[model samples]
Target: MKRSWWKIACVVLLVYTVVGGLLLPVPALRQLQETIRNLYFHVCMWMAMMTVFTVSVVNSIKYLRQLDLRRDIQASEYATTGVVLGLLGYATGIIWASYTWADPNNPAYASFGSIVREPKLIGTAMALLIYFAYFVLRSSITDMDKKARVSAVYNIFAYAMLFPSIWIIPRLVPSLHPGQEGNPALNVNDVDARMRLVFYPAIIGWTLLAVWITSLNVRLAFIKEKNWLNAH
Candidate 1:
């Protein structure tokens, strides 16, 4: 049987994640044990979010430099995708937390309320909220040129805030999340080799998926704009 490239890629990734994760010996599987399986999805969603946000910021810069409306549109699509991925990442993280930290009934679990209040989660929410305001700002402007130009500027500022709020500030305070103050989730030495194998691919898969979704949205936007132009 034959398969499309994406189908083949998906199969390969799925098999890799499953096989590599499960094949590890019980003693070698890190402290998280089977719970580490969540890493494949949770980490991937975050990777996708970061990739989309980076693209959004780049498009914003290009728009500011060239004053092009298309770049603005591309930036919007990227930001939209990034927000979705970020939400998914947050949800996955929450679920993982519930399993690992929540449900005090289980001796192995910690309190959900405490884990939910972690700096990383709070900071991430603030970052996403800032981007959410970007959409609101874009919608409020009636003039096309003004909307694009103003949004381009705003995007630059918003992207700047994202790093500090989501990455920097979170790391500054102690939290239940993986990394310590001034450190990143990816940099922690605690992550074992088995986790790395799945975590890296999850990032790649999620990023590719975000890009694929953004490309579709861009095409749809172009088609809609062209049709509207013809109608007018």
Candidate 2:
């Protein structure tokens, strides 16, 4: 595949994130220390995932209105890629939390298992499961048009569930995830000026990469669809 300028930009920005995120100075908050650098990678993954999923829902809505299989294809590819990013984000959070929140000498939790039930983690897991079920719904039915319509409706339902899970339910509980005042990711006061430079770029870069991956899948699906139609 010929690389576009945007793809090259994604590579460059990500390279900058890797180098600067490590070498750049960050706020020396107590306990968080060096591990706070996870902000660039972990938080960026989540923000990018959210952006991609939002696009997925928009595509789903288009599919619903036009009953276009191509729109459904875009929706599925973006949702799947977003889920991949969400899983990666969740994994990175666990590693960071284990180091910071579960340091044996000054543990944040009584047991390691407690980390598994983190409010933010639970919220993100719910969102991921809902989309995974979307894929399962698509696979179960043999009729293409019916499958697209039903699953597109489910996609909008999944979108409705997404925001509440990540934003509302987590806020209802006493979470160690730290959004009491407001979501740290969005709070101007919470993120340091220095971190913001790398953080925003990281979000854009990661999202472009996710979209690039989705485009590849969509192209493959388009080809497969064409071949299948010809055979029939």
Candidate 3:
């Protein structure tokens, strides 16, 4: 029996992520406990969101360079996938924060409001808003050609803002979110070897999943357009 490469790869990654997470040594496990397990989902979601957004911006650039409708469709699909993943990632992070910061009964916790006000959280919200505006801008235009062109240009601007809004500004401000203001979580040295084993593969798995979804979205969009064109 021949196994599908993608299926095989996904199974291997799932096993590795789960087993590596379970096998962490006592001291390391104590430092993170069960909360550390959230790393697999939380980190991977963000990584996948970033990958999708990157592709969206790249296709936007290509559309601008060539003024091609196909590229525009690709960019739209990618952006839609990115937004969905970004929202999911934010939701997961909120859950993680609620567990670590909002539950007073937990000794290691802080306050929910404090986490909400964190710079990273604010910046991430702003980034998502910017992308959301891209969809709005696209929808407002009736001319297909003009819509694609304008969206392509808007995508370029939105992509430019993404880095500073999501990455740089967050790090510059003092915050509880990891990897900010010299937070040790940014350091590879800070993550135990066992965590690394799951963390890296989780990134790859989630990114691939995001790509697969985006491709399906693009295909669907193409089919929809074809149907519309035939009807008209």
Candidate-wise lDDT, in order: 0.75, 0.84, 0.76
> Of models 1 and 3, which has the larger lDDT?
3
User: Could you give the C-alpha RMSD of every candidate to the true structure, in order shown?
Assistant: 4.0, 2.6, 3.7
Q: How close is candidate 3 to the true structure, as a TM-score?
A: 0.84
**Predicted candidate 3 versus true structure: per-residue lDDT over 147-210, tens digit per residue:** 9999898888878876766657765666867666543333788777767767888777777777
Tens digits of per-residue lDDT for model 1, 1-232: 3535774575677677667656754333454657767777787777678778889989989988987677888999999998998899888887788666666575433465567678877766776887899899999998877898888888888778767676566656667677655444477475666567676766666677788789889988978777543453
* Model 1, C-alpha of 167: deviation from truth (Å): 4.3
Model 2 poorest 10 in a row by lDDT: 175-184
lDDT for residue 41 in candidate 2, whole number 0-100: 90
lDDT of 2 at 65: 85
Model 3: residues >4 Å from true position, as ranges? 1-8, 18-31, 103-110, 181-186, 227-232
Sort the candidates on TM-score, descending order.
Answer: 2, 3, 1
- Stretches off by above 4 angstroms in model 1 are 1-11, 18-31, 106-112, 182-185, 227-232
Distance from true position, residue 57, model 2, in Å? 0.8
Q: Estimate the overall C-alpha local distance difference test score of candidate 2.
A: 0.84
- Model 2 Cα lDDT, one tens digit per residue, 1-232: 4759899999999999999999999999898998989998998888888888899999999988887788888998899998999999988998898877785875566746667677777777887899889999999988888888898999998788777667676666676776654566788777899999988888888888898889999999988898544454
TM-score for each predicted model, relative to the true structure: 0.82, 0.90, 0.84
Predicted model with the maximum TM-score? 2
